[model samples]
Target chain A: MMQETVITNANKAYALLKADADKILKLIQVQMDNLTMPQCPLYEEVLDTHMFGLSREIDFAVRMDLIEVEEGKALLDNLEKQLNLIHEKSQQR
Target chain B: MMQETVITNANKAYALLKADADKILKLIQVQMDNLTMPQCPLYEEVLDTHMFGLSREIDFAVRMDLIEVEEGKALLDNLEKQLNLIHEKSQQR
Candidate 1:
């Protein structure tokens, strides 16, 4: 593909990833709200797994030259930080 | 919480997981459709990472007694089969 097309696809992919990550975070928060057990292993497991997937997807984009490696890593790092905040919020409840 | 409430929550979680899984699959298929390279490592990486995440989520649900172990395994198996089909379709293109 042309350089322009590649850039466009990369931006599109990043946008989709960001949108989905936000949605996933909201879903996890919803689960946490209804959770009776403060130490819900199941909830943690799902969140961890989801984060793992996102990290890999970002890496893949970087490797495909669709996005910069720094960009991908930064995105994952931001998501991880958000995930930790969510966990902390749940723990406070 | 009461057993009834637990059951209700479990059902809701499963429903949400199922819905999200379907959405993810559709998103992946879209990515595959626009892919110029048949052997897109990035695409496969994202898909594999996603499947890994889902399997972990299912395992957590089973362990937490939200769903039966067998049911969790079955769901993962079916997803794997569907994922393989998607991969095959992409390869044929």
Candidate 2:
């Protein structure tokens, strides 16, 4: 029962982190779709702020032992790759 | 046992948050003690980043139901008060 509870918390942490990453991806997608220049300072600031916030949450989860460090890194990396693809598509337009 | 585990996690979350807040306070204290101008843009940026990071952690904990929303707000508000006090002291110097 104790182990099951721990696993549940870990799963919850992972789901929350993924949801946040997806939100950032969608926000960037909307910005790109609207023709917001990727080079715009405001766009950069918004991305930076969101990324920082998500990273902090991931770090907290890792420190709390609710999520693995590698898991957190992978989540961030996956988001970055998607964002990069969007950036590339925007630049090609 | 399940209830106890949940309480343990919540206690851990609160303790971790308090530690992070204290670290920020110490960092600002050191900066002031070294006569680093609080008005400096770099100082402002550093403080902003740290506060944002801590707030993110607190938000995540609140969302996870590991801490009460009021508890999280109180933690942040208390830190803000201490930081303001430090800023005022620096200004008087």
Candidate 3:
């Protein structure tokens, strides 16, 4: 029973973190699609703020033992790669 | 057993959040004591970043049901009050 509960919480934590990462990606995508100015300082600030918030959440989950450190790092890394791709595409336009 | 586990997790969550809040307080205190520049933009930026990070952690805990919404809000509110007091003291100095 104890094991089951831990696994449940861990699963939930991973799902929540992924959802937040996706939210940030979509937010950036929307900004790129609408604003057409990836060079804007506001765009960078918004991305930085969201990334910081998500990193904090991941770090909390890791400290709580609900998620592994590597898993948390990968989540952030994956999101960064996607965001970078989007940024590059926007800049090429 | 399930109930006990839930309570244990909730207690842990609260303790972790309180510790994070205290760390932020200590960080600001050290900055104020050493730098003596509360009016500096860098100080404000640091405080803002830490506060934002803590808020994200609290929000995650609330969503996970590890802590109540009111409890999380209270934690942040209390920290803000203490920080404000510290800021005021430094300004008067």
| TM-score, one value per model | 0.49, 0.91, 0.95
Q: Higher-lDDT candidate among 1 and 3?
A: 3
- Per-model C-alpha lDDT, please? 0.66, 0.92, 0.94
DockQ (Cα-based) for each candidate: 0.10, 0.67, 0.71
Show where candidate 2 strays beyond 4 Å.
Answer: none
Error of 2 at B71 (Å): 0.8
Give model 2's clash tally.
Answer: 0
Model 1, span A37-87: residue lDDT tens: 547776766676678866655544454444688887878788778867877
Compute the DockQ of candidate 3.
0.71
Q: After superposition, how far is residue A65 of candidate 2 from its true place, in Å?
A: 1.5
Q: Is candidate 2 or 3 superior in TM-score?
A: 3
Candidate 3, position B88, lDDT: 94
Clashing pairs in 1: none
Please state every model's RMSD to the true fold in angstroms: 17.9, 1.6, 1.3
For B1-93, candidate 1 gives per-residue lDDT tens digits of 355655775686576557657866787778867764547776665666677866655554454455688877777777778767887887776
Stretch of 10 with least lDDT, candidate 2 chain A: A35-44
Candidate 2 residues A1-93, lDDT tens each? 778878888999899989999999999999999956899987987788889989999999999999999999999999999999999989888
